[model samples]
Target: MLQRLAFILLAGMLGLAALLVLGIGFDRLSKVRQLDRLPITQLNALNDGIYATSGRVASDAGSLTAPYSQDSVVFVRYLLEEEYTNSKGERKVRTLDSGSSATDFSLVDGTGRAVVSLGLQISQVDWQIRQTHRQQNGSRIYTEHSLRAGDLVEILAHFDRSRQRFELPDRVAGLNAIVSHSSLKIEGGKSLLIAGLWISCATGLLAVGLAALLVGLGIHRYWVFVLVMTLGLMAVLWTIGLVQLKKDWQIAADLYGRRSAAVAAAPANPAALADLYAYYLMIERSASQWPDSLLFRMAAPYSFRVPTLPQDAQNRVRNRLAEVQSSRFAEQNWVLFVVAACWLLTGLLIHFALRAIRFKRLVEFIPTSKTTGLAYGISELFGMIEVDDRYPPLLSSVNQQKCVAYQYRIEEKRGSGKKARWVTLDEGGASTVFWLKDALGRVAVNPAGAKLIFPEKKVSHEGKIRRTESWLPPFRSIYCLGMAGIADAEASRLSLQNSADFGMLITTQTEQEVVRGQGALGFLLTGLALATSLLAGTVWLAGAGSLTPLDLLQVSLLVPLTLALITSILHYNGLVFLKNRVDKTRADIATLLQRRHDLWPQLLVTVQTFLAHEQDLQTALRAVRDGQTGASGQPQNIAGQLAHERQVMARLEAYPTLKGNELVQTFVAQMTRNEDELALIRTGYNNAVELYNNQIEQLPDLILAKSFGFSAAPMWQG
Candidate 1:
């Protein structure tokens, strides 16, 4: 039973595989055929035909046309005279030499002319003798015109030469001739057989899919069956693709040959439309040769004689044709084909290989544990909670605590799976875990407090709790608090750092920032450098005639190089200046941070000391006056000035006896406000400095500075 089942499974799989392979092969073949359509190939052919015909006509015309002739006359022609009916139904006959030989003639249109001369050469003929016709309801008209000495010709030729007449023929004739004379019909039919094999292979792909499914269901020994079927299908598709390609190649080659003949026979005078057609033919021939030759080389088991031009002027022709030959073979179609084929094969192989494996053990091993009671169900019910406040409820629960009952509700899902799981509670709830339950009726664990039960699984909460004395560390928070007061000092320091007077490193940092557009200083340096470089170049060139080659090289090279070096030095100096300024700014900020740190601790002490002597007139006055004495003494004494103003205010408020003394209190109040304003100005300066420093360090400006050999400034530090 097992063996039978395996066989059946294998057969189905092979059938499906065959179908898929054949389908893909045919699809590819169809695409190839579509791509080979007349428009694309023929358009290319037309261009080549024009070029080749022009060359031949020009070559024949020799110096008469020389440069212009090579480009002017597109094709050569030979005329064949015969009587034909005109558009008015009148029969006319005219004798004229097409300039080549007789015998290359063929019947063309059934118009007034018996044979139409078609090529660039036909344009050489006088227009009076040709017929005219209107097409598309008179939208366009074709007329015969006379050729002048310098006029251009574009037409194909027809021959009337006797024994040599049939020497070379148009593409269509060439194909007919080959078919009639050769016995390759049987071989050609083999392509049809190959196509059939492809169809069969495609059928097998479908079979493979079916077999794989059966194997997954426990059929034994199916793999061996799959392997044999797959291999056979692949072989068949390969053969089909190959054979079809060969057949197409032969067809293209035959078409190309006929076109070449037509171009060769084209008329030289009165360049006709036929000449363009002939030129198009030549292009097709050249194109066809590439694929045919390539495939023949690759597929042929034995050495074959490669086609060659006829012996009369073969060497000269080959040499002359070298450029065209090279260009033609380098076309992209063949490369595209090879790439497409490789991709197709790779995809097919991967697909079939995967199907063949049919491994289901991995899937079968997955676990599905069920939670007991309503615990899981209730948990799921509580999982739906809205991240946004407005949403419908999924479930509701109540839990009692002390004298209050907390009400909770589950809302819509916030997200998916574990991430989505959530629960919401009414405003009065003390704990969310008490009322929640899973589908299995077990109590749901509260993730926030459950960590105590499983301590190892709990996230660490070390950083959360802390003494409330301060929210941030002293140095870090002081900058934020005293920004206004310190900013001006920082800006002044930064400016000094960018100045060239500070020497190379600081100046260079500044220049780099300017170049990088990080600071105003860099911009100034960049402009100066550009102007200097230009000036140097101009100066070097001005003395050009007076200098020898060596002298010119020395002078010119030195000018630019020297200027660049100077610029680099200047840039370096700017950076150093900027660094120095940054350092100074850092110092100022450090001082402010230190004062803030010290001030915070002294807040209670200062307040208590000032308030203790509040009622003692002499002591309070002495304290206020002594604080004022040292307030303005130091340049960096903002803290002292503030302390002094505080003491004076405390003295007045406590004394009341001093309230009527407006002058002293007023002076102290004004000083306090002035200090605050100065602090704000300093903050603004610091921010500006930070912005300038940051700008110099960013993109574009940074890139510019680096290009100019400018280095970055150090961060302001004290």
Candidate 2:
């Protein structure tokens, strides 16, 4: 049987170990796959375009109108400036001027090549251009431009294909050509296959390791099954990551090669250059919205390189760059890292905890030695003891140790089995102990035990004392006594004679101490909590700084700490206050009881006189109605009865007592209930005050509060 159990446990441990490994593997694979699919290049291209546009705007003039022609035709004129290299490799400048009415423009290159190109009509007298250019150095540029009427123009001379590049302007010297580039295209091969294999192998190994660890430690049976299923899921995710990584790697390599070739083949046509910039600008803009994608990073610069006809386009680009930098994009990365770290730490802690619980091999049980010397008996069975060599009798054990005796009151049914009659026991005395036997002579250890129970108190020569009577119902079958002792025949006889006298004195003293303690503690705690809360609020309110969202979050974090500190201080103060109040109240109650006792004789005498006055009044009224007295005699009798009535009323009204005594039975009861409610209200007020004060003192509110010279509000005392 032991071997089978061991085998089962081992199998479970292995299963759990496999599951943990699989979960970790799956998470890593998912992250890698997400990174692979990111459009980094595209984002990069867009970001660059925004920067370049702003830069160009700062240096260049606004758009201008084309001049009029002699044929009564309105010719819209604009300049396109570009740099190019001749066949001799010398840098040269090219300019192309087009008339709105002209259908063609001619360009002469430095090498005397002449080129003629047909003009395209642009409407709205508004110049809008979008372009894409691939440079020789393997960089792509995308540009977008919009120019209003009356903007300044700088023209670039173009190559004339017919003349074989023969144009030179005074400003053309030393101007270099703008080389263009394009993105590379990738295809499938061996590299992709290798990448996939690596991913699969790594994931499989992780899954297997996790499963083994889980199985090594015992977990719920359901979790073992879950681990098995998780392994398969992890494998599928790993495969997906492998495929994505392969695709991105190929694309990155291809893009690099294509950019180089595009830059080498130069175009002297300014219109073509403008068109290239505009196209790339669009591409870059599209990528900015996808910051996480790898393509955005690669494509972003393309937007920066695009040339603009007007200055405003460059300004727009520069503004975008500033915005991106100002956004604190880098900070977000740090935030993500911190959050992930925290989650990982939490998960690790949970895993360790589970492992600790599962592998707990130590067996612990109650020590039988601790129960030795304690009385062993069913508490309800009264005197009958189940004597065990290892365990002491319950009552006898507590008395000998000077430990408090606890008894549980129980209700047992006679006939109906389900219902029970409530019974109290004196477990310590002989009479109560002797009644524990059942019909068959077996000692009833359960509800049938009618053991006498005693309250805790110091035992004196007088008797085993009762400390206080609890008006509240006894909890379960338990009652407590001060000391542990077995009530044998000798002890029982002596205790019965002196118990009543001993009990009264102890009960009165105990009641006073307990009540006084509670009241004093409550008051002290409430005051302290309130004070600490206010102090914390004041300190926070006094600090200075502009409060951003992050600052607000920091302040919010402090809230719980502040609350905890305040609560602790309050609790301690409350205990002190309650203790003091309880002591004071107890003294007051004792005095009142003493005064009532002293006044009892006088009160009884007054009651007898009042009863006599009532009898005299009845006699007087009967004599007057029967006309049995003379007129003068009747008046004297009436006066005597009236005087007696007044005396009785005066005695009843003149009783010296505490205020509101008629409404309350005892001073202790009145003060306890009243002080308790007051304490509750005070506590609630302090909490509200603390919360409001803290909120106003922190972060965004704190900034506003300081500017206005706002101070922390005081807590309510009531």
Candidate 3:
């Protein structure tokens, strides 16, 4: 249920993001279309209204060197960055340079020029360079990025013809005008084709929304069908948008070409413009001299101008386009951010999907096998529990249920309502090597790391905040899967041989519910992987090269096919890690089995020896009753089988080595100690399993278990 909620939330966010991008695309496209219809005017035509024009920066005023590169620039801004180490030993970089700019330059057209006044706001300019230097103690300083001189500029400003200060002849004076509005806004290059971009973004948004709706409506099983259909429609829309963009570019180019040609052919004779220049000055002076008349007020803001050469107009248009392109390149933050988000989501989905796949394989490949005839490698084993009599049996602290091994935990609720949480007060569990007997034979199991999915017996107390105790009881038929190998042993040992590199360890409890969970995770992960991969591809292609969002859809249209290949490689690596863990765990289990195998024979021998001694002592007692008492000393307490037997023999040194009932009690005690030692050895094997399982389950270390495939072993119970 949590997963479903998370998924739905993510989908909603993505949809909203796409919608936002689409809207932005449409807005930009609208601006571009407006620019196309806007009438282009020459600088010589003075008027009192907003006007768009392009020109080159003039070095009429003194220049300052760009902070980083020290390049001469008429107007520029830059940032200085300094690097330092913080208290946490992390390196950080911060801007140290304050913003600076110069506006003491002039803008000139082929026919006339305007002296740009000081204190007027300039448009946003990205003219800066970056540099870095190391201090003696290894500190570093740098700049980010910068712009320099010779850059073309396109601007929209207010023009006023009444504020002219220069005294030129009537003809030239009429052409002179004042331009105001300090804040200059850099034009975007793609602004011309913005309408086409808008259409593309809107179409893309619709495609995604449609796909999402279909999937939400239960068409998810045939996701490829939805993807193919949407992609096809999107492709058509994109083609149309691109075609429109191409046409606009061609139109602008043609206009520039014609203007250039016209300028080249026009005669440069001053007499051709003499009549118009005289007429413009007479009208301008008359407009200012006379007021309150309809014609005077109507023509008051108009300034006549001589026609400039077509070549010069072409140059200005070309410069304007160049400036637009530069600005567009700089304004790519939105596109880059969207692309990054796509990659991040894709990566997350792929990561979880791969983990699910690994776990699924584990559930399928590991078959539950019988304890008898179990192979010497990692294998699943299940059987009835048998406890060795020598070692103490485990008793649950909560209910005091007897078992070979058990674990219990105590938890209490700490907070109330939504903030409530279960906090553990104290917890611990212990295990010993227990017998798992089937029809054929028995196998020892160590249940340390296994996710013990058993019928947990819980006891709850309605106290301050509800305390609960849960436990994994013993004696019931349980299953386990982990590393199985031979353990170290003496030469005379039979070596039941289980684990090697590490000891017996349980990774997970074998239960039916866990198997079902594995299957569910597998299916979910597979679906997520496919969906995320497609999303990444679509985002990459749709947002490529500054493409904007359609009304409701947004993404790049360019894709790198190698992303799929990389994902495959990552999955392979994950599989390799799992395989390695399985192999190691198998070796560890085998080592314990080997030692147990060797100890079994030695234990049998000790039991046989004890029986033989008992028989000999009985015979000696019979002799003593028959009036054949030996001249041996008093009997001593027996600490060990061999020692007690020798003591009995020494007492009868005058007679044969066979003694009487003098050491009978000692013999029984020796036998008991021997049996206990044997049980302890088996317990040692169980402990090893517990330790190995624990190491894998530790946080951070648990990452290995989750990724590399280390399953916990079930404890052996007698």
Q: Rate the local accuracy (lDDT) of all candidates.
A: 0.31, 0.30, 0.44
Q: How does model 3 score by TM-score?
A: 0.38
By how many angstroms RMSD does model 1 differ from the true structure?
26.9
The candidate scoring highest on TM-score is 3
Among all windows of 10 consecutive residues in model 3, the one with the lowest summed lDDT is 629-638
RMSD of each: 26.9, 28.4, 19.3
After best superposition, candidate 2 residue 138: deviation in angstroms? 59
Q: Write candidate 3's Cα lDDT for 1-718 as tens digits.
A: 4544544554466456655664555455434433332333445643333334545557676777765557676554555566787765688987666566664565666756654444443333222222222222245454423323444454444444455212111111111222212112223343423433444444444444444443343333222423443464446445544544444334333333333333335454332233223322322332232121233354334322334445555454445444332113234565567557756775675566555544544544455656544543445666666777743467767667776556667777876766678888777776555666667877666555444454565666767434344454546666565554333332211122234432332323454434444434433444343344444444343333233323113332321232233334434554454445544433433443333233324423433454565556445433333321111110111113224333543444443322233343344444344334334333434444555566566654466567766676544343
**TM-score-superior candidate, 1 or 2:** 1
Q: Higher TM-score: candidate 2 or 3?
A: 3
For residue 285, model 2's alpha carbon misses the true position, in angstroms, by 18
Clashes of each: 141, 192, 87
- Candidate 2, residues 526-564: lDDT per residue as tens digits? 222222332232222211111111222232333234333
> lDDT per residue, candidate 1, 441-486, as tens digits?
3222222211111101111122322111101110110000001111
- Residue 109's C-alpha lDDT in candidate 3? 66
User: For model 2, what is the C-alpha lDDT against the true structure?
Assistant: 0.30
Q: Count clashing pairs, candidate 3.
A: 87
Worst 10 residues of 2 by lDDT: 361-370
Evaluate residue 679 in candidate 3 and report its C-alpha lDDT on the 0 to 100 scale. Answer: 40
Candidate 1 ranges with C-alpha deviation above 4 Å: 1-237, 249-312, 325-365, 368-718
